[model samples]
Target: MDIRQLARGTVEWDRLERVFRTLAERYDRTVVRVEFLEADNWLSTPCVVDDEWFVKIVTRQNALVHALLTTGRNVGAITSGTGGFFDRFETPLGMVEHEYEATKRMREIGLNAPRPIEAFEVNGLGVLVLEYLPEFETLEELPDEVVRELAPELFEMLATLHEHGLAHGDLRAENILRCRGELYFIDATRVLEDRVAETTAYDLASAMAVLEPRIGARETVDAAAEYYGSSDLLSAREFLEFVRFRPDHEFDTTKLRSEIEKVADLDRG
Candidate 1:
């Protein structure tokens, strides 16, 4: 069994059944077909309803796990000489609501994201509904050449978020999707509103980490340099080691740091 599955403890069938029934009633349907997905994450149990809506069932256990992860991330941030910027939600509803709003906000600002349907609690479980993208490829699943071609576009999208005083607190390759040749971001985590600058730098660092293995470190930095300035790169440099510590991320941090420093030096010169 996957360790993530253990961490994201299974929800009782009776409770899940209640959720499905509620969804069917809410959508005015007599029945609904649920297709459970083996999505790799500890935050939520994901599924598809009637092949139209992507649904996430957030339980109390998921919320507890999220709080623990948030603490660890904040500690990493502090160790990186920055204050904690990641926010924690005490309840499952908060988690689902935040993602719903985040997706809506991203689309409002002309960024590519899933169409959020709604977030509501049912029998103490937080249920989130969104438009399902039937055909898609995560960045990790795509070919290296395809990732290389999309590297700059990824940076541009991140820049657009920062320009609007927002940040994608979680930016693993899994959260970025490609559907029909267009990029779509999903599962944005909540961050402290007042620390947008810190979150932006951390997001830049995370993006570089995701791309470095698929493309090279130099190319990764070059893609970022197009949308970010020397100061932004320098700020992101502080979070490179911190981002490396994440379990989901594996990249050559030393080489990436060197590339970022070289570009920053050139900009300074």
Candidate 2:
């Protein structure tokens, strides 16, 4: 279907406008205009509506929708893109369909994720409305205490995903959202099956790499061990081994080991 039709298809433009309006009113703000944010590596053009909310228009070839965000909350609708690689990739509408389905399935399995509001297809573009989370921060910038609290929960969720034979293709700090003492994962576009263990390991390793510098080695190892509930998942020795395995990435294990020993001592004390 065409862009106009898609915009007014499953979700009537009137209804979408109302939603945006309601949000504006509820937040006591006004959106006078929509501005273009960064477009490229995922078409994300945000409409600047006053200072309260930014209506992000994200589109792929066959799918497009506006993601509404307040200064504090991220919530909005999914829509189709009007141009770019949509045609070049010849990406079937099925990819979007699968993504929403996977997200729902993950939620059903008790995974921490954004709540899906609604999903439909218009003019070949798939769209989903999801809960907007506010006052969230990325895991990369979180404090050690916060990371300690989040680590086990995240690992538990990862373990569940592995147990259920699912994997989030792009598992990274940016994709994880933390709000009000809870963690919510976003961006399930690359969900896959049959490689859960490998995928989980890769994600864990990636998270460790990102967290190492910020958290230091010992606390990092302690957190991993605590999260995995087994020294085997990532013991201090194993962590050192893993670091050594990748000489290209320099890490200080001496400090890490000391920290782990200190944690152990604390536990005993």
Candidate 3:
């Protein structure tokens, strides 16, 4: 099967069920209503899931789900859930299963993470069933002022994680969510606890990388200070200075100044 079909966001249930049978086989265990989170392709397909059970398929637009499908991989499809969402990857089931375990670990440490319902594999693909979180806005969606206000809270969350011997392997803007005045770190799929200090530094650096740009260096520093009552935490970025995914920390200011001076000299000439 072509991998790209998963991202097209237009797979009908009848066409999708041939390889893996969820509704046909586990009819009673799955949710009856299947909602489509997307609206790209709807061709008189009133309800492919509408059969003996009178089920409705619903779809919700999700960036992570889109990301998984864009790679054109379908390890498994979940035909039942909050809205019948599915995530499949060409990668091994082991990788996806790590996400489930990470979520549980975060939850154990008093951090908010969705619980994993079940996981299965089909056709050499990994399919995960995660608890559906209806509506939560990521830190990426919030305004700068709000981010500044919550900066200390963000730092505290990182501190809590480190204290529990864990690190948010994939700490980024989109993974941190705010719901009803409380912040919830949603995507702990990459959460793990090896090299506690390095991982802790990684989490702090990642959060600061995002916050420093939006709220400026001083306010970001203040946030960290508010958490630990010391500026030491602000320097956590040094531990991950060379991380490829992270932005440079003015590591070349002198070089940048030299180039600027050269351009100025040429313009004057």
Best candidate, lDDT:
1
lDDT of 3 by residue, 25-67 (tens): 5545444444433222211111323332212122222233534
The global C-alpha lDDT for each of the candidates, from Candidate 1 onward, is 0.96, 0.50, 0.51
Candidate ranking under lDDT, highest first, comes to: 1, 3, 2
Q: What would you estimate as the lDDT of candidate 2?
A: 0.50
lDDT for predicted candidate 1 compared with the true structure: 0.96
TM value for model 1: 0.99
Better by lDDT, candidate 3 or 2: 3
Minimal lDDT window, size 10, model 2: 71-80
Clashes of 3: 13
Residues 1-269 of candidate 2 have per-residue lDDT tens digits of 55444442343456446545655555566754433333122323233444334343334532333211110011110111111111111232454455567678789999877665544434433444455565668786688777766776776676676667776644566667787778877765442344344445545554555456766765566666665433333332333434333323455656655655666566557
lDDT of 2 at 10: 42
Pairwise TM-score winner, candidates 1 and 3: 1
Candidate 1 residue lDDT tens string, 17-61: 999999999999999999999888898999999999999999999
The predicted structure with the larger TM-score, 2 or 3, is 3
Give the TM-scores of the predictions, in the order they appear: 0.99, 0.55, 0.60
Poorly placed runs, candidate 2 (over 4 Å): 1-92, 123-125, 227-269
* Ordered list by TM-score, greatest first: 1, 3, 2
